[model samples]
Target: MGIRLSSVILIAASVGLLSNCSGIRLRQPLRSTEYDWRLFGGSETRTNAAPQFLEPPLKLVWSYDASAGFGPSALSAKDSVLFIATLQGELQVISIKDGERLGWVSLGSAIASAPVVDGTTVIVATADEKNNVISYDFSSARKYWKRTAGPVESAPLSVGRLIIIATLNGTLLALDRDTGEERWSIQVSQPIRSSPASDGERVFFGCDDGAVRGVNAITGNLLWTARTGAAVFANPIVIDSLVIVGSLDSTVYAFHVQSGEIAWKYRTSGMVYAPAAGFEHRAVVGTAHGDLLCLDTRTGRLLWSALGGDAGGVINAAPLIVGNIVYVGTLDKQLYALELSDGALRWQTELPGRMKTSPAVFGKRLFIPVENRIVLCYRSTSGEE
Candidate 1:
């Protein structure tokens, strides 16, 4: 199916504005402590890394009941508040310390991905039959503004003045964070189910068309595009100068950001959907066949593989690596904690439903959302649910 020509023209105009420069800049050095992780993957880059917390087998502080049904990942912000956009389309902000419902805004549409926050504004992309993006004030529970778009399956990313979103129609949009106005958009072939990434100067995302494209963070111009063997569904990760992304072709790729050249590609027995967790020269990840593998990021050489129990044939979430431990969830309804260095099993926790979302580790707890519609809090200590 082709995207509407009108939408194509709209995106082209916005990207053209990037040539003007003098748009937005981060004043101080970009710090992880400032922004709230309102989306499925964490941050605008979707790094999904929280260096503050030790890996799971930690401890569950508390678990709260979500007013709406399951969608994807829940939002964990900085103010000890957890924002959840339910399948029913209501946005709820809760106290992370106690799971208390602080406030809620009814969007009257289904939210597919986790909402992202910029300053006091919480932005949510609705997958309603109407297809719109809405912003709400986290502090006051008021509607900020709303704009129509294609079906947004990927999570939204916020840089400075621009909020980047990837849609199922195979386009990336840059919108004004303050006014909800269009800034620019870039078109790609195939659908975009994976979230986009930013490194202050460029935006990167993967698509079902078997390619990963990088665009100017300022101008929306295509900076580089790299081909993969199959579709990509996970958000890409940017660390230093390297861009790491995964593909359904059973491989994890490491690419050179500035040159658009392949650094390495690690193959697995099953399809891969989530980005790899990197620590210095090594990277760790899981496969759809239920095996967790650690590889050399520079050479794509496998270091170790731990065969997990037969739960299902696919792994959807990225592994969370903290210090010496790597945590991963499988379609088998199991969450496993393996040794990061050797892929040894430390402990495993089972939930009532299949596990598709990555675990959110904060403080000493792992916030795991199961497919059965229950948001579970597991203590890293005993691996108890």
Candidate 2:
């Protein structure tokens, strides 16, 4: 069966079935190769920046079908490999250069979120029929450990030796990186959809209860909580002292990382599904109403906006900002390139189905996942310069 894209997000948030076991411990921060792009938006800063492709049209180089359901956002390493988790509980490692299938490993459960990798291990928080978190060693391709928690549709975040995640049951769990052991689990008033974001000393995450919360990363202590207008399904982006998150209320809210006070709120016509992409003084975000908007990061002022076809789609996935171009996909099954400076269309490509996963860019290659149960790799027609 195909993934229930529209119903999947809602069901994942309403069902909190926290039941399962798994084990790991890396106290002093296991010394592995640098996992530069660990979070949903690449870095904690969520810059979404990579070198630009030369001014040329892009073409599909190769395609890999997971043949299960939808795939999550593809993650890339400086080493030039793409990592992805599937709804069928499969993990795949592919070469970014030629889209060669390097390796495929099964974790034995459905993985709804992107896998976070650090050093030798790739941590995937999956939802079994029983609901639990499973950690694995990507290098050895072995099950390292597992931890029982509520249903996790959101991806887990790794900060040093700690992994932070949320559940539909209104529980926020902190797991030790090495041991897969629970650091702590804080109970919130309502269910959570926003994945956690870390700024070293503290963790910032969003919840469906219309609250954006901050918790102490080390002690799992509640730092502060601020309420928004409606459920918050989008992930928050942390830029130095500012925390940016979007809500179903059709608005983007920025808060002080320490005080949790509203720095500014930018209103949109439709629900904002992803965090704002910040570059220089501007931040870019897409609306469920099919409009791409750019706002000033400091004051939340509108810099520019562009309208696209509804395509019966929402901007659920975060956009990839390469140089001056912003790349994003829609339920319309179209990949769009917009000028970051003015929100103008650069080019658009059609895919077979809806694209729930964000684009992963490395050098000149763009790897995108479509709900048609296939992952595609495209390169600029002129090739990498």
Best by lDDT: 2
TM-score of each: 0.84, 0.86
- For model 2, residues 1-385, the per-residue Cα lDDT tens digits are 1111011000011111222322121222322223345546676555565545434367888898776674345454434566677888776665555666656666667777778776767778777634367766644445677778877777788776888878878888888989978888899888777778877788888888899999888999898999899999887877647888889999998899898999999889899877667676777888888777888888989999876454435776777777778888887787888888887788888888887776666555667888877888777777333
Tens-digit lDDT string for candidate 1 (1-385): 0111111000011122224211111122212343234555565656665544355455555666675565545455543456676777666655555665555556666776777766667788877535378876533435568787787867788888888888888878898988888889988878998788878788888999889888998889898989998888877887757788878888888888887899888778877776666665667777777777888766778899886456433567777765577777787777777777787787776767787766665444457777766666655454222
lDDT of 1 at 154: 72
Pairs of residues clashing in candidate 2: 22-146, 23-145, 23-146, 24-178, 24-179, 24-180, 25-178, 25-179, 26-178
Name the top TM-score candidate.
2
Model 1 root-mean-square deviation: 10.7
C-alpha lDDT of candidate 1 relative to the true structure: 0.68
